[model samples]
Target: MAFASGSRADRPNIVLVVADDQGWGDVGYQGHPVLKTPHLDEAARSGLRFERFYAQAPVCSPTRATLLTGRHPNRMGVFTWGYPIRPQEITLAKLLREAGYATGHFGKWHLGSVYRASPVHPGRMGFERWVSSPNFFDNNPIFSDEGTAVPFQGESSVVTVQVALEWIRKQAEAGRPFFAMICFGSPHAPHQAAEEDRALYLDQPPALREFYGEITGIDRAFGMLRQALAELGIRENTILWYTSDNGALPKVGSTGGFRGNKGQIYEGGLLVPTFLEWPAKIRTPRVTRVRCCSADIFPTILEIVGIEPPANLPLDGISLVPVIEGKWERRPVPLGFWHYPAPGISTPSAKWMAELLAAQQKGEDLPPDGPSQRAGQLPDPPYPSDQFPGHAAWIEGDWKLHRIETAKGKIRWELYNLEEDPAESTDRAAEEPERLGAMQKRLEAWLRSVVQSLNGADYAGLGESPSLPESKSR
Candidate 1:
């Protein structure tokens, strides 16, 4: 095992819960007028709440990719939704499993097709056990049970949590340290909630009833999971982390008065609610305005386990351990975001994925790349920086710089003082020349580093090349 074995107390259990498309104002603690997120609100009050936490990307797949690898999504070619993470990139599950931790993933697994034999399937991606759906699913959805379609009962969020709780209980009974990631599909699309949950929003507008109810269901499920930890007598030592994948979804979603919505590089699109509860480590519950991103999660885990990351891999995020211990205040490094203007490759439908799994179970000959193999097929090597096009940004303290390339091939620069104008209402590109120049230089340099990783530079001496022939085409 990679992690040096130690006392049971030295290896803390970790639970990471992610909500799909939930926003900063989705929880009642953030002062949302209609949404009832009691469980999340309680979490914020009893934990270290992050006032300025950000998702690495403004989309699901990209932020998720970063959460596992500690590198920017674009580096691994996960540009947008409907894309699979390149198999070469390291994942948190794999890391934890190697460290003698029981790891399981439950709920939505949008990183790749859940079909059997797919190289990027949750199991192949390092998850020891996974009960997952191909993408966002509604109530009573059919899940890929370790690559076989199985019907599940009850609300989407509730079912996901129940599945995760079952695995957690077994690990707890075995006295084994474990890592569980519960990715809820509720409040994503086709916003569907149970009839009882929808009844709570009867006074809400008919159009928003389902959406609000979905959030409530998520809150209920979250509350159940937390309560389970307490009942299992494993609440204090376990680190429970909660956050959304990205920002709000425009009108129906609330961004807490920031500018832009999902898919945009604006503050509203990237910033999301975040909280970390480790009763054994953090005794005081307080909120901090220090800027942090999803990329930091992987490094933070390594720090908690007292393990060093592989030297060859480059991480874009720093550990938040100091912050948790109240030894750090300001973030030493600025956060960078680049939404490469690239369309994500589409995977096969759920039906086709199920059919492929059945063929595998019957000993049928299938393609080596498995089902959904046609989604991504990379070209020959020599991938250069110029080929990676995108609108990039760099956030240093309060200052933010945006670089946009128009369809006409014209470059435009815009700067914003986020501390003064959190909404990004004013552009200070012309007013602040020196600051703009410095930020632009930093942004470009960061992009160059990311490009090198995209070209398989980071994996050079790691024994495995980063090239993904049937993936990473993003």
Candidate 2:
């Protein structure tokens, strides 16, 4: 598609909203028995709902990285939750800002440090304004406003949306196109919900009341945001996309009957509830089961705004423009997911932000070498070029193949026809040898490519320090 450099009115405003640790079966539209997500349900009904949407990873930060860069997180060395996005990678926000759009980010910014001096801070990543937290936060949170800690009161989701809407309204009044990433830190662990929201689920267990209450708060906050858009008269042209960072939490969250939860690479872990509303482009409501992932977000937005992605940038995600326009029923490219065994880096939002706030109040500063700035520090390549540890999966059409690397160095492969077995309860590897072999070969090749990217082959002249392996790929 040609780059869209049309008038300001011709370009659609974009709002990407993400929920933290929200499960596939958490919303009312998805047949959740208890949770009431009236706002999200209406949005799903009125727009394009995705039946098989997925987070690129089964955790937080990696999936967020994929959403921002249109590449697998592993490609940029963001292997798990709490990992920071590589500063060398091109971000969607930076591209949009360069294309004459005002860009801002609110709420959880788990991809990297929110400190002003951090190389991977939101400002460095192209957002002009940011009220972000280093990790998930609950009510009455402290956020970094371009690196200065600012305390805010109220429910976390409500405060996040209100702040974003304030910036959005200004851009709308000025008649400039804007892109806002509103990420909500809700229903994660230590579930804390506003009392009123918690009251809605009185009949449920105490733990569930808190869990469901946070979702209810998110639902109400989402409603407030959507209502504001309509009230501002920018609802028609704005593309409002809603999805979760990962899958459901264990015990407290629901996955709509998929196998595993959260950390696993099963359907419950990767699959997420997703919907997009763009009234100007999608006049009619529809639902699509064509497979898509968080990585698709960056490319899809770029195609919509008519921005050409940087040449030679390897994107694991394909433009979903065709899917949005109702032109394509199937994804042309298969989605690949990997769970590298690297441990998650620690980034406690409440603790870190409090320290930042105290330091600022006392006219002091935290150490530059703190864990918050670890995202900018590249690690040495410890694994061999051919050694891909942990679990990986390849998805093509209705077939899914799993490549498991046991800790003892044993490798196992499992294949399942997801169409017939959503839970992956029965492995079809033994039943369908021919299909299994083809998928296995394709998956191995893809893993090698990811390893090459991880080793910094893609940053040839990008000025990034490449952690090149001693030997080339076998």
What does the lDDT read for residue 86 in candidate 2? 79
The clash count of every prediction, one per candidate, is 0, 1
Clashing pairs in 2: 4-306
Q: Residues 127-204, candidate 1: write the lDDT tens digits.
A: 787888877888887777776667777999999999889889998888889989899996887788799889999998
Alpha carbon lDDT of residue 224, candidate 1? 99
Predictions in order: lDDT: 0.82, 0.87
Ten residues in a row with the worst lDDT in model 1? 465-474
The residue pairs that clash in candidate 1, if any, are: none
For residue 323, model 2's alpha carbon misses the true position, in angstroms, by 1.1
In the range 179-295, model 2's lDDT, one tens digit per residue, is: 899999997888998999999999999999999999999999999999999999999989999999888889989999999899889999988989999988788999998999998
Which one is best on lDDT? 2
